[model samples]
Target: MNLFKYWKKDVPASLVVFFVALPLCLGIALASGAPLFSGVIAGIIGGVVVGLISKSNIGVSGPAAGLTAIVLTAITDLGGYEIFLVSVVMAGILQIIMGLLKAGVIGYYFPSSVIKGMLCAIGIIILLKQIPLVLGLSGEMESDRITFINFHEKISIGVIIVSVVSLLVLLLWDEVLAKRSNLFKLVPGPLIAVAIGIIIYLTMGQSGDLALNQSQLVNVPIPEDFNSFISNFTFPNFSALNNPAVYLTALTIAVVASLETLLSVEATDKLDPMKRQTPTSFELIAQGIGNTLSGLIGGLPLTQVIVRSSANVMSGGLSKLSTVLHGLLLLLSVIIIPKLLNLIPLAVLASVLLIIGYKLANPKRFVEMYKLGKEQFIPFIVTVVAIVIFDLLVGIIAGLIVGVIVLLLKSYTNSHSMLIKEFEGKKNLYHMNLAEEVTFVNRGSIVKELDALPQGAFLELDFRKTKILDYDILEYLDEFKVKAKNNNIQIKIISERGIVDDPHSFREFFGHKVFKMGH
Candidate 1:
C-alpha cells in the first residue's frame, strides 16, 4: 500500500493513461448524446474518486463506451439529459446496494466465451464508430451508423492524410521505436500520434483547401472567463425523481454499468503482471459512489473500462496512484489549457481508437478462439455478431444464452462414461463413471444409462471423481435404484469417501456437503 514506492513508473504510466483516456471521455460523452464536457467530468471523477476507493492496482475507471447506446436511448426516453441524470443517480444507489448485497459474485457466472465475445463486439463497434471520424466523412461525433456505403460520399482528403500519418507514427512508435529506447517506451504511441496529427493540421492549415474546419477537430468548449468556465458544469434536475421512467432508466444504467465494470475488473486482473486480485464488491461500491457523484454534477455514468485499464497496465502502473494522477492531469488540462486540447483533430483521436479496436478484435483472436473448439468459438462469434447487429446488452445476452446451451450440451455428453467389463466366471459388470460435476442437465442421459442395464447384472457406480451431483440427478438415481433391485441388478456405489451399500436416502448420503455444491 505504499503509493509512492513506484512513483517513477506510476507517473509516466498515469500520463500515458491520461492521453489515452482524454479523447475516449470526449468520444463516449458524444456517443451518449450528452454534453462533451460531461465526459471529461466523468473521467476526472472515475480516476480520482473511484481510483482512490477501489482496491484494484491497475484498473482505471471512466465513461464507458458500452453504455453509450443505453445512455442515448435513456436520454430520449426520459425527455431530457437533465432528467436522465436522475436515473444515473438512482443507478449509482442501486450499485451501492448491489455491492453491499455482494451481488458482484455475478461476475463469476459469465463464461469466458461470452466475455471474449463482448470484448470483440465492443472492438468492432469502436472501429465502426471511428471510421467516419477518421475519414472525416461526418462532422457528427456520436453517430454509430456510419458504414462503408456512405463513407465514400463524405471523405475529406486532408483528414484522411492526417489519419494515415498519425496511424503510421503510432505503429512505428509501438512496433519499432519503443523497442530501441526507454524514452520511446515512456512516451506512449498515442501521445506521439496526437502530436504528429496536430503538427500536420497546423502545417496543412497554411493551404486554403487543405485546412481542416472547426468541426473536423476536437471541439472542447473554451470559456471566455472563469465564470463562463464554471457555468459549463451542470446539476441534475431532482424534480424528476418521482417519475417511474426515471427509475427504470436508473435500473438499466446501474445494471449495464455494473456489468461492464465487473467484466473490465476480471479482464484487468488477468492482465496484471503481479496477478493481484481486486475485491469485486469493493470495486462496485467505488463505482457506485463515482456514478452518484457524476450524476449529481454533470457527467455520464462510469465503469472500469478495459481500454483504459489495459493501457494503465501496459504503461507499468503499479498502484491506484497512477489512476488518481491521471484524473488530476485531466482536471488541470481542462482548467488551464482547454484551448490547446481544442486544437487536436478528431481524425487523430479516431486513429488512436482504431488501433485499440484493432487490438481488441484482431483476426488472430478469432483464429485462437476457433482453435479452442466449437463450444468456445460459437458463443464468441454469436456475441460478436449480435453486438454488431444489435447493441452491447443484447449481444451479451445472446452470447450468454449460447454459452449456457453449450454448457448443457457438454454436461449431457460427458455426464457419464459407460464401460462393460467381461470378468471370467462372474456376472456381467456394468461400470458407470460419473463426471467431475453432474447437474440436472445430465439427468436424461444418466436415466437412459441406468435403464439400459441388463437384468441380473452387477452395476458399479463410480463417484470418486465426481465433485458434485445435482439433487435432481440424485433423486432420479434413488428411483432407479429401486427399479434396479426389481430387475435383479446389484448396485455398488463407490464415492470419494467410501462405498455406499444399498443406500436408502441419497440426500442423507450427501449430508451437509450438498449445501455447498453450486456455491
Candidate 2:
C-alpha cells in the first residue's frame, strides 16, 4: 500500500489554498517594499521547500503577516531592498542554530489561550489594513511604495458605498447562502465575490466620464523579456553583517518568525482530521531550511501561516502534496503569465481577505475563550489587548509572563504547608491533607516529599474526601510506585475508592471485581 494514499484527497483543498495564497503573495509583497515578483518567489519557496520537509499534516507556509512590520522597517533602514535581503539571510542562520540547540520545546511553553489570542489579533490587523485597498484608494503613492500614509487620500463616497455593500454580500453568503443553497457550499463565496468585484471595477473603469482616482487601479508591472524577469531577483550585501543594527534586526526577525511558525504548526495540528500532531523539532528544521532558501532567492522569510493552513483544512487537504502543488502553481503563474496576473482587481482580492479576517477575529472567538475557564480566559484576553497595543512578539512575551505568574499563584494557593504528617514507628500509617482536587502542577512538591522517605518505610497517601485527581497527577503517582519499590517502601493509598498499594491499577492488582467506578 502507498504510504501517502491520502495525497489524492487533497486536490480540492490545494486549489482553494492556491487561490488564497496568490493574492496574499502579491499583497504582502506590495505591503513590504519588495518587488511584487519577490512575494511570489517566497510563496513558491515556502510551499515547495518548507512543505516538502515539514512533519505538519495541514499547515501551509509562506510570506507571513508577522513579518510585514519588520520588512517595512528593514527596507527603509537598509536604504534598499538588496540590503534587507542580507538581514533575512542572517535570520535564517539564527533559526538553524536555534533548531540545533533543541529550542523547539519553546513552542510547548506558550499557553493555548495566548496562542488563540495572537491568531485573532492578526485577523483584526489584516482586515484593518485592507480597508483602503477595497475602496480603490491605494494609489496615493508610486505603485512601488506601500505605506500606511497612502491612506491619507480622501476615499470617494462611491467606493465606500460599494465596499460596504460587498462586505454585506459576503456576510450573507457566509451565513444564509452557505447553509440554504447547496451550490454555495460547493463553490466558495469568496471566489464569487471576487468575480463580482472585478466585474464592477471593469464596468466602472470603462466609463471615460467618471472621475477615477489613480489609487483605485491595480498596478501590475508587465515584464517584456526573460532578462527583465531575471533582473527582478535581488541579492543581499553580506557587508551589512558588521553593523550592530543589522544584527539586532536579524535577532528580532528570527525570534518572532520562529515563534509564529511554531504557533501556526500547533494550531494546524489541531485542525487535522486525524488529530495527528507535528513534531516541533522537525518543524523548526523545515522552517530553518525554508527561510535560508527564501532569503537566498530574494524572497521574504516565511512561517506556517494560519490563513493558508485554515484554507487547506477547510478545502479538504489530506496531505503535504497539496501544499507542494500550490507552490508549483505560484511559481508557474508568475513565469508563464505575468501580464495575465495583473488583470485581477485589487478590490476583488480585498474582499477575499476581508472575509478571512472576519472569521479569525469573530466576536464568537472571545465568547468561546471566556467559556474555557478563568485559567484560559484571563491569559487569552491579556494577549489580545497587549497585541493590539504593541506588536506580536512583545504581546506574546507579556502574555507568557502573566501566565507563569498565574500558574505560580495557583500553585501556592493549593499547596498545603504540611503535605504529609507521620505517625512515629507506625507502618502504613502516614497522612497527607491535600486540597480537594490534586493536579500535576502539585507533583513537584509531592514528589520531593516522597523522595525523602527512609528505606524500608511504608507510605500512606490520605485522600479520604478528595473529589478528583488530574490525569497528569495520576500518571505521576504511577511513576512513584516504581520509586517506592526501589526503596523497599510500601505505599498505601487511602481514598473513598478504598485502601490500596497502587492507586492507578489498584482494582487490577487487588481484584477487578471489587472496583465499580469509571476507569
Candidate 3:
C-alpha cells in the first residue's frame, strides 16, 4: 500500500508515541523487576509485531503498567524472572487459543459503562503511580502505595523539588502552551517539555540537586556482543507448567491484559476520526501473539496502550504502518544508542508521562460523564476511585461488578412493576397494567407477556395508571396489531387519554393515542 503519503502525519505521531512509550517501557520494567531493556524489547515487538497484525486503526502496544504487579508477584512466587517468563509465553499461547475459539467476544459481555470506568481508573492509577517516579523516589520500595507518601525512607526533598517543578511545568505547558500556541500543533508540548527538562536536569546536575535521583536513571544494558545480546533473552521455564503459581500467573496475565487491550481498543476507536471499528477478535489474536512472543524472548507482557494510540491519532496515522515504524525506531535506538539513552533523566520521562496521565484522567472527563446522566456516572467514578486505591485490574472488576448489579437491579425493578392479569368472567380478555415510563430495556418482557395471549383472544392494555410508554414497546404493539388482525384477536389499549388503534412505526407512532381510564 501507498504508506508514505500518510508519513507526514504518522511520523510526528510516532515520535510523540515513542517518547510516551519510552518511560512506560522502562518504568513498567523497573516495576516488574525485569531488566529495563526487556521492557524496551517488548515495546519494539509490540509495535512492529502486534501493531502490524492489529486491525485497529490507531492502537499502540507495549509493556503494560497494569501488568507490573502481576509480573513482580510472578517473579517471586515462581522462584525467578526466568520461570515467570515461561508463564508469560504460555499465556500468549492461551491467548492464541482464545482468539481461535472466538473468545474475544467476551469483551462484548461487559457493559459500555463498565469499560469506560476501567479506562478512567487506569488513568488515575497512572497518575498516582508516577508521583514517586516524578519525584525520583523508588517504586522499588513499595509496589503498593496504598497510603499517600509512605516515605519508606526513600524520599528526598531535592528529588521532590525537581519532580514537583517538572510536573507543574509540564502541566502548565500542556494547558497554556498547547492551547495558546500554534507551535504545539507543529511541535508537541511533550517534546518541548522534554527538551526543557533535559536542560534543567543538566543544570541541576552541575549544581548537585540531581544526585539523589541519579540512582533512578534509565539503564539500557550495553550488549558486549551479539552472543551476549542473544544470551540476555530469557526463555520460559516450561517445566513450571504444572506449578499452580505459573498457571495462576498465566491466567492473571491473560485476563487483565485482555481486558485492558479490549477496553483500550474500544476507547481508541471512539477517538478515531474515521470511527472504523477494531475487530476485537482479531485484536485479541494479535495481542495474544504479541504477548506470547514477548514472553518467549525475555520481554514484558504487552497491551494496546491508549496513551501511545492517542498520540498516533492526534499525529495523523493513516494505518498500522505508523505503529510498525515506531517499533523499528525503538529497536534501532536500543541497538545503536543504548548509552545515550542512559543520559535521559527519569524526571524528564516522568514529565512526559505526567502530561499523558493527566490527559487520560482529566477532570473534564468526569463532567462529561455526569452530563450523560447517572446511567454513565456511577461506573465511571467507581472505576476511577478503584484504580486510584487498588490498581488497574481490581478496579475494573469492582466497577464491572457494580455495573452488573445495577443492571440486574434495574431489570428486577422493571419486571416487578409490570402488570399482567386475566380479566374476570372473560375467557378471551386479558388486562395489562402499564408503568409511568417504559424504554427499550424493558421491551423484551413487555413483548413476551403480550405475545402469550391465545389466538382469537381479546386483549386490553390498561394504561390508566401509566404516565409514559416507551417507543420500543409501541413498535412491538404495532407489529402485534397486524398479528392480532390476522389471528382474529381483538386489541384494545385503555389509557387515561382514550382508546387507541394501531400505530404505525413511520406515520403516527409519536402522535397521541386514545385511552380511557374510567369505565
Candidate 4:
C-alpha cells in the first residue's frame, strides 16, 4: 500500500513530526528513569522500523507518554534499567504471539471507560512527576512520591522564567496563532516552546545568578566519533530473563502497548481523508518487531502514538515515507548535533508534559462521564480512582468488575416486560413477556416474580419473544406449574404456537421445540 507516491506531501509532514517527537521523546525518557539517549533510540526505531512494516500509511510510532508511569514503576521494581529492558523484549515477543494468534479482537473487549481511566491516571502521574522539574527543584525531591515536595527546597528563578515563557508561547500558539495562520500550524507549539527554552539556556544558562544545575538539563552521550556513538548504546541483562517480575511487567507492557497502538490506529484511520482502513492484526506485529529491536539497543518501549501520528496527518502526510523520514531526521539530529540537543532544559520539557497531563484528565471528562449515567459513569470513575490510587492493571481489573456487576444488575431487573390489568370480574391478572433471549441469569427474577403472584390470581407467561430458552428457566416454569395447581391460581402459557389448553402439557410442548415463532 505504501508506494511512496506522495513524497512531496510526506516530506514536509515528516519534518513536522520530527519537531513534535523530539521533546516528547526526551520527556518520556526522563519520567521513565531510563538513560536520556534511549528515548532517541526508540523514536528513531519507531519511525524507521515500524513505519516499514505497519499497514497504516499515516500512523506514526514512538516512545509514548502513557507508558511513563509503568516504565518508571517497572524500572524501580525490576532492580535496574538493564533488567527492565528484558521485560520490554519479552513484551515484544508476547505481542508477536498475540498478532500470530489473531488476538487483535481482544482490545475491543476493554471498556472505553476503563481505557479513559488508565490514560487519565497516567496523565496525572506525568503532571505530578513534572512539578519538581518545572519548579527548578531536583527531580529526586519528588522522585518517589511527588506529594512530598520539599517546601524549603531552593528554586531556580531562571528555570521558572523559562518555563513560564515557554508555556505562554505554547498556549498562544495553540489557542490564538495556529488557527490564524498556516505558518503557525506548520510550526508546532512544542517545537516553538522548546526552541525558546534553548534560547534561554544559551543566553543565560551560564551566568552566575541564572546558572542552571547540570542535573536539571537534558544529558545525552555526546559522541565524538562513529565508534563513540555506537558505544553509547545500552543492552538488556539477559540474566533477568528468569525473574517472575520480568514476565508480569512484560505482560503489562504488551497489553497496554497493544491497546494504545490499536486505539491510535483507529483514531488515525478515522482522521484519514481517504478513510483507509488499517489492518490491526498486522499492525500489532509491526509494533512487536519494533519493540523487540528497540529493547535490544536499550530504547524505551514503543507504541503507535496518537500525538506524532496526528502531527503527521495535520502536516499532510500521505504515505509511510513521512513516518520513516521523520525517524531518519531524529537519528540524524542525535548523531550530527548531540551537543546542541543537550542544552535543552528539563523544565521546558516539563511544561510540554504539563499540558499533556491536563488534556488527559481534564475536569470536563468527569462531567461528560457523569452525563452518561451510572452504568457507564461508575466504571469510569472507579477505573480512574483505582489507577490513581494503585497501578494500571489493578485499576482496569477493578473497572471491568464493576462493569460486569452493572451488566448483571440490568439483566436481573429487565429479564421480562410486564403489565398488570384486570379483565371482567378478574381481581388480579399478571401478563409478562419474556425477553428475546432468556438465559440462566434471569432465573432469579423469574422465580421471584412467580412466587409473588397473588393467590388465585390469573398469571400469563408469554414466550412469543423468547427464542433461546435456558433449561434452568424451563425447569423453574415446570416446578412453578405444580405450585400453581395447589394454590388454585390459574396458569396460562402463551407460546408462539398459541395459548396452551393445559398447563400440564407446557413442558411436553418443549419436547417438540422451545417455541414455534412461525410454522
- Scored by lDDT, model 4 comes in at 0.80
Q: Which clashing pairs does model 2 show?
A: 139-215
**Cα shift from native, residue 432, model 2 (Å):** 8.4
- lDDT scores in order: 0.84, 0.72, 0.72, 0.80
Clashing pairs in 1: none
Model 2, backbone clash pairs (residues 3+ apart or across chains), number: 1
* Sort order, TM-score high to low: 1, 4, 3, 2
Q: Pick the candidate with the highest TM-score.
A: 1
For candidate 3, write residues 466-515 as lDDT tens digits.
Answer: 55555666667778788878888876666655686543441153343432
Tens-digit per-residue lDDT, 1-519, candidate 2: 232667555655566677678877776887777887778788898898888888887789999867887888988987787778878888888888888888888788778888888777766765675767666565322111123555666665545544665677767876898778667766655556655655655566744533344345444456678898788788887777777877788788888889888888776776688898788867877888888888887988788888788778766688898888889887777778655555455555556567766777889999998888888888888887787677777778888888887887688457443433456756544456666666657777777777777787777776664555566566666677887788887777776667776455543432333222244
Per-model TM-score, in order, reads: 0.86, 0.72, 0.73, 0.82
Q: Residue by residue across 22-65, what tens digits does model 4's lDDT show?
A: 76787578778888788889999999999988889899999886
Where does candidate 4 have its weakest 10-residue lDDT segment?
140-149
Error of 2 at 195 (Å): 2.5
